[model samples]
Target chain A: MSDEVVTPLSHEECWQMLREEEFGRLAFRLVDEVHITPVNYAVDHDTLLFRTAAGNKLLSVAMGAEVAFEIDRYDDHHARSVVVRGGARILHEDEEHRADNVPLRPWVGTPKYNVVEITPRVVTGRAFRLTRPWLHLTLDGLGQE
Target chain B: MSDEVVTPLSHEECWQMLREEEFGRLAFRLVDEVHITPVNYAVDHDTLLFRTAAGNKLLSVAMGAEVAFEIDRYDDHHARSVVVRGGARILHEDEEHRADNVPLRPWVGTPKYNVVEITPRVVTGRAFRLTRPWLHLTLDGLGQE
Candidate 1:
């Protein structure tokens, strides 16, 4: 792995970075709108799971239909992402994540909450570093020195 | 302030509940795609202020773009929300919340972070007691009531 400033992180590197993250953002679209929510999640193979209070964040993503989850990480000029394109159906009430062990901070002074589990079938990612807008490229070298 | 089975909390009550929260989700759109991040924030009057490690979030939303921030509280069957849809811009780097006195467990895990402030032009909310698909809503309701 070289310290080259112009190299892009590989597809596998992108997925690895995303998986290394214990938390991620949940993205969803509805009509002309899209919503993203922050969640404490664990990547179980190819699925994404997080706990929410059940109303806005969880139900809003329901979107009266399907939704998407996007988890990404970036440092200054380098960004790598992995997206899970799949329809999300709210999980059965708080059995998974055990509800009691979720490391979530209460944003509404509430003591308890529910959980949502998403199984993603289509997982894809992209990685690149920008030396400002005038110079941007994908590190196709796979970070090999 | 009726303790009826479906009593709705007023805006004041909701804001008070939200004030106790120091974390929230910031959602935005870039290239027709939605992205979200969780931040530890402080409520300044009506706006949401937090810090970021700098990336697409700052690029997309802070460059005079629209975004959304949501916070909610939920119990076994009752929930309430407060969402702000407006513009997010970079706040002064020396804001009060930047104090070293604050303790935060940030995923970015670095001190080179920047402060972001989200000023919501539209603040909307609704409360409900949901049992399965049947949603019992209160004031500002937008779903099945």
Candidate 2:
């Protein structure tokens, strides 16, 4: 049997997955290092919107750094992942009013007044079938006896 | 009731979560931009180990770039996240032999001959209670009648 179980996801499928999931990890460059944090987001008109407090995440967007956002789901049989690479910008003045309708909510009680939008430059994803090595070993041993 | 529901996880709790989860996202800098990809990993000693092919991830390790690895879990009521920030190095020669005992296998069928280890400089995490805004709004509307 061929061992290659990975399948590439199409553009439409990628956007659909992004719409279905509300939580994801946001990765951004901070000087010489990279940082990743989990954020709850909403997909709106081909863009991703998330709210954050005034922190390093907000600082990175203020600096206009390119960021990557990813979401994935997996079970015992299969796994899928989607990644969006884009430029992040904080909403300002009139734009902030537009974001008010996106239905985004922060999980914590802390005030997250900063609403950031990620305009994706490239979106990519893959799906792969999972293999349980220890389970396979046990089955193989049983068959050998 | 206070809206703030996030609680900081102890260092011990962070490592415990890391040991329990098999998959996480690895974020690293590639030139001017940052990238994040899902990976299956193993917790060996105080470090994290994963296998990868000769790709951007391996190249980043060769460049001695600092990276971030994150794993999280959430349910209807709560969410927990852990992030590890540190330098990644590709295990070589004798070190590769040591990594052979880590029990990490690739989800894909492709050959992944390179083994990389992340020695973390800082490990931080948080646990937060989730709020379902739509559900709460629906209940509030029902009571308004």
Every candidate's CA RMSD: 14.2, 6.9
Clashes of each: 1, 1
Colliding pairs, model 1 = A8-A139
The most accurate candidate by DockQ is 2
Model 1 agreement with the true structure over B3-93: per-residue lDDT tens digits = 4434455667656655565545666666545555445566667666666665644454434677777665444455565666778777565
Candidate 2 Cα errors over 4 Å, as ranges: A1-3, A55-63, A135-145, B1-4, B55-63, B135-145
Model 2 CA lDDT for position B138? 29
- RMSD in Å for candidate 1, one decimal? 14.2
Evaluate model 2 with DockQ and give the value: 0.39
- Model 2 lDDT tens row, A1-145: 2355888889999998887777899998877878899998888898999878766444554357899999998865678899999989887857876566766677666765677889999999988887756434332321100
What part of the reference interface contacts, as a 0 to 1 fraction, does candidate 1 reproduce?
A: 0.12
Which candidate gets the maximum TM-score versus the true structure? 2
In model 2, residue pairs whose N, Cα or C atoms come closer than 3 Å (at least 3 residues apart or on different chains), thus clashing, are A109-B3
True contacts kept of each: 0.12, 0.61
Give the TM-score (vs. native) of candidate 1: 0.47
Give the 10-residue window scoring lowest on summed lDDT in candidate 1 chain B: B136-145
